[model samples]
Target: MSFNNLKSSIGQALQGLSESVSQKTQEMASTWPAYAQVQQRLAQEKLGQITDISQMPREYIDLEDRIDNLQNSIQVLLHVTRVYEEPAYDWPYSTQESVQDWSRAIGSRVQELSRASSASEAGNLLKSPVGPENGPRTLNYALSQASLAVSTLTSSNMPGPNGEGLSSGLIAYSDTQAKLAQIRIAQDTQVQTKFNKQLREILNNPIAKANKYRKDVQYKRVLYDIARTNLQNARPEKEASLRVEMETLEDQFAQITEEATIVMQETLSNTHLLKNVAELAEIQKNYYKQSLELMNDLMPVFNTAKGDDEDFEIDAKKDPLAAKKVVDDDE
Candidate 1:
């Protein structure tokens, strides 16, 4: 037999053994006093089998990899399952529905994370598993009552523009939805804070500073998508103002681009919160230069005006034609 056949055979045998042990443990937990000891012995035996199997040299590297991957997955599942694995337990009636629903949500999230992780592990499953085909059936157990969650927290209907009142369940659902939105915002803020810090450090090196400046500019383009989404979701109360905030952020991005031109200068080491502080420093240098030029140009005009005033007063005191002569000379 090929090594893949052997590994598959081994995997099948291990799976069967695991199920047998689990069944026996469940049965003995209620029927036998030494059930814990029995479970421990089974686990130790399985561990020994796994250790021995891993020591063998095999030609089917892919099969070996899959076997190892499945083993690790099984271990993780076992660890997760352990949380609910009390030897012999009875379900309480009062909070059973809530508990069931919470478990369903957790299971759904786990499945999502699992599929995502698996796709990442093997590179084939790029499409989101939550799409139309298998989504409703596979994810039904994890569904949440959004409207109910919202009403539960606020004890009031979320006001719509039409002035229609929603039920308590809907209010609970809305409350939960708002919480989720806030959580997403918090996560974004946390990520942006890290990016800002990293950009600060990157600005310490001139080349890195330039690279990060370009990166920051490029990355901010993503904000357009985010802004569009936010705009789509924005309620009538806040949509206009929210758009303005997004616009301001975009304007800041543009200002940063304009400032980036200053990085051509030699001194580029000192840095700050913006992505390209050295470039901003150059912007400041240019701003100062323009201000100096303006003053230089204005200074002569002011001085001449003042001098002309003095000459007018002297000419008025002595000869009127003297003031005209001064004006003609200036022209």
Candidate 2:
């Protein structure tokens, strides 16, 4: 039989024993009323019988064990568990639409700057401001024009172009140099010289010259940072152009550093290039355009002018004789 059926049978047998004991105790109390000792003894016997009935479940110990095993198996099944990891791209961890929007906006700004650079280079846009309000007007119009021009390119391609353009800022072109100079004047000079004088004075009261130098350096740091940011956000084609500009800037930086090193050789025996330590270091940098040009074309024009200049100088000493011969020949 099943464990449950066995347990039920034991319980029913115990109940029947209890009822029989109670009925016998009642009969003895009624029939042997006169004998107090007999009545007391019968009550004691009934108590023992009830205790035995309660303990009768122990007689079916194997059935109890079977019941326990069934219970344990059910508990084991309940204890078994399954776990799973939630998605990583859930609300708090996932990227937002705003991030993409800002990236696009920054890309658009870079495209605008590239167009402006191209327009200025092509002589389509005027270089200098015509009036006090002209700067903003020109900038806005140039940005609008750039948007119109770059509208053909899809949105997905924007980041790639931007990264490539920023890479190109490593190029050093003449136009980039001009723009960098302009950026310095427009952004750096005023803040360092006029705005931060009180701070400089507080920092070093007696060293006016040193204070001014520190302030200038700090200002340049800010301007270079902005330039680097602009280049980083620029488009790939523009980045290529920027690469040319970067080279030019590097050459200029090298020349300046060389001069500085010569001047401060005694004071700074190990003087290195300032551009290396300068803030937004990659921003004010450029690629070697002449080297690139040389790779593309090997012509006499690219030859060293030193020997030719020397030959010209030597021939210049015989100019009087040559001129006399020319006059005689003409006659």
Candidate 3:
């Protein structure tokens, strides 16, 4: 760069630095008095001299308290509603492995067992390398497993009454339970998406924004009060400037207070809360209705089985000797 250009650039940089420092110094000077005044007010409050500090309008104070209560209620609701987001809350055990891992391990073990050459090798292979700990521990999963075991054990080429009724009933029960589990999962999803999600949006958005405005109003009120106090105690020579500062702070406080009031009013009047509550009620109603229907459908099968057992007991009582002979043969 040429010498003249370099000097001009340096002069411009220095001017900018000087302007920035002056701006910062002015800001600090303006802020320090307000900070001191706020501290003085707090000290007076602690000493039970609250009358010296300015009081907010009764309506504004009431609004603040109501907003606080609303926020606390929302927090409590969110805490409980979060459970709906976790569909596996009622699962019997924690999942230690993914489904794919369990499936792969079981498949590999079975394949190894199938290739065993001798009885000793087969026996060793028969020992499970992975336990049921890796499998889903949901009630539906347990029921399904039970159904599979019963079906496997009772399966036969020859048709007979032995084990047939029990296998059929158990399989049907498991199927019904599986359907109920699906419905429960659907309910949880709906609650999480439609109810809890909306609540969170309300709490995080309008409610939170209103609270922020409330804080801004509070800060501005403190500044206004401080400026007023300064103006009241000012010497004759400083009175005019102090009065001007107090008026400016008063206007700022009023504007922020108005904004905060509007925000709080809107937050309190929000219709989304009612909508979310209705959605939750609807989801729960559907869940219970479906569950009741499934249970009703399953009842007849078990009732018939119960009746058959009662008939056998009545027949046994009618022929006690024959019943004893059969029992002895079974033993």
Q: Say which candidate scores most in TM-score.
A: 3
List lDDT for all candidates, in order: 0.44, 0.38, 0.75
lDDT of 3 by residue, 1-331 (tens): 9999999999999999999999999999998977887777767777997666667788888888888887787688889889877656676353543465577778878888889889899887776467434333456655766686666676553145546666676778878877877888788889888888888888899889988998788778777877787788899999999999999988999899988998888888873555677788999999998987787666556545532234223244565544554576589
Q: What is candidate 2's TM-score against the reference? A: 0.15
- Encode model 2's per-residue lDDT on 1-331: one tens digit a residue: 9999999999999999999999999998875643553344446556773221112123234433433453344334323311001111122322343355457766665555577756555354343322221221122223333343343242334455443332232222223333433443333333333323322332233233323433433333333333344467789868877666655544544454344333333222222224222422332232233333332232221221222123122232355544444466589
**Per-residue lDDT tens digits of candidate 1, residues 261-302?**
344222133333344334434544654555344333332232
TM-score of each: 0.18, 0.15, 0.69
Residue 68 C-alpha lDDT in model 3: 86
Off by over 4 Å in 3: 1-50, 96-138, 150-160, 306-331
Candidate 1 regions with alpha-carbon error over 4 angstroms: 1-204, 264-331
Residue-level lDDT for 148 in candidate 1: 53
